[model samples]
Target: MPLHPKIAEILAILPAPPDGPLDPVAMRAGEESQVPPLEQRLPLHAVEDTVAGEVPVRIYTPVEAEAYGLLIYLHGGAFFLGSLDTHDHIARNLAKETGLRVVSVGYRRAPEAAFPAGLEDCYAVVHWAADNGEWLGWNGETLAVVGDSSGGTFVAALTAMAQDAGFDRITHQVLFYPSLDLDFDVDRYASLRENAKGYGLETGILKAFNAFYLDSGADPADPLVSPIKRADLTGLPPALIVTAEYDPMRDEGELYGKRLAEAGVDATVSRYEGAGHGFVQHFSWLPEYHRVYEETAAFLDRRAE
Candidate 1:
């Protein structure tokens, strides 16, 4: 199928590629320019809570009293640039759609804090949400984990760690166009590299970000570093994995979903044709994006029930 018309138009308007290597600063500025301004509405309740000694998190609760499940979301920025502000719209939309309280973590980014630091921050927030669910008027046992792109990488890692560490509070996991493996040998990457507009993610830029985020001491194959490397995926919560038809990460995400199914985990994987990476964040601009949001909400609602 051809690319969506709106996406094609947006791609045409993108600025010229940078002459130098892509750094965190450049990535942040590029993202801001491409995306629309985030909505300024305040979270129903924004509270700073400490996790794992001193890791701080900002939790956003929905206004409705209808007791929805808790969704602990980690924002995507290739482990470097995203913040509560950058991903605030997503948190708000998720909260409103599922009637779930969305707790968005301000996880430490790299090159300052590499590999495990960002993952640890996300883990801490999940643990904190589970421990203090009732205090925040949420059902702890009904907690879900969600993320996109690099954040999806963390989500995959955290889910695996949670299972290994006996953090059984999570009931579901959602990944949108997730980068599941550090190994970039997949055919999808090759396909993307050949077509300029096939994938929004630049291969070289992605490689650069991965290099900066991984630590010298970290093994690329560690299940905590790459969830797809895990030997056992059993007993993990049911998952809803969304991918883009033309995304470089598409194959890996689909492969992970397959592994989950093989391990007896209930998983639903969907790839929207004519879409590329980061479509979930553009729900307000694209009808296809809105369709994804509705599908995701329906999936969550059914699972929660």
Candidate 2:
């Protein structure tokens, strides 16, 4: 299938790749350029809440009615970059489309915080949301965890941890083009290494991010570091896994979805033929991105009912 016309146009307009080594500052600026201006959008309620100590969150509520469920959203950045502002559109779209309240976490990023630190922050937000459901107008019976890329990695780990600790409150888990495996030997990585126009994820860059996120102290194969390595995929909430045809992480995301299904967990996996890893967040520029949200909202709606 050919790439969507809108996506193709955006790709054409994107500036040529930077000349120097990829540093955090350059990566941050590149990411910011891809995002819409924050002030031009409708404001989400920003709150300072304690999840072990004061953490900030931007909460989006559907205009239709009080939400029947809450989505604790973690933004994607390969564990190193990105912030609440980068994912603001996604959070708002999910809330408005699904009629669910969304609480987007601003977890600590890497180099400053590594490995389990960001994961733990996401977990803390989930715990906090579950504990404060009523006050937040969430039904408690229907709560979910969702993310993309590294954020999806956090969602997978958080789901595993929540299940192991007997926190069964999660109704569904939604992963969009997730980075489920830290190991780089996958065939998809080799096959898509040169795909420059789709989602900007390259094999070399992914390897670098993995090294930074794991640091020197942790093994890359550790299940927490790579959710696909986890032994028990049973007993987690039902999941909806979305992948893109050209994403380097596509195979791993599909494998994780299959693993969940094989473990007897209810899971549905879908791969968009010409889509890329960050499509869900880029819906404003690429019309096809809207389909991802519709699929997610439909899945959540069924789970809620």
User: How would you encode candidate 1's per-residue C-alpha lDDT over 1-305 as one tens digit per residue?
Assistant: 88788888887787777687666777777666654453545445443444434665656666756465888888887778787767777877777777777888888888888568889889988888777766767854468889988889888888888988887888889999888877665364454455334456655556676776764334567877667888889888889999887777777789899999999998999988888878887544477577766776777776533
- Note the residue pairs that clash in candidate 1: none
Which pairs of residues collide in candidate 2? none
Please list the residue runs of candidate 1 whose C-alpha ends up more than 4 Å from where it truly belongs after superposition. Answer: 29-53, 186-198, 215-218
The models' CA-based lDDT, in order, is 0.76, 0.78
Instruction: Give the TM-scores of the predictions, in the order they appear.
Output: 0.89, 0.89
Q: After superposition, how far is residue 148 of candidate 2 from its true place, in Å?
A: 0.8
Off by over 4 Å in 2: 33-35, 42-53, 64-67, 186-199, 216-218
What is candidate 2's lDDT per residue for 169-199, written digit by digit as tens? 8899999888887877645454345453355
Per-residue lDDT for 14 in model 2? 78
- True-structure RMSD, every candidate: 2.9, 2.8
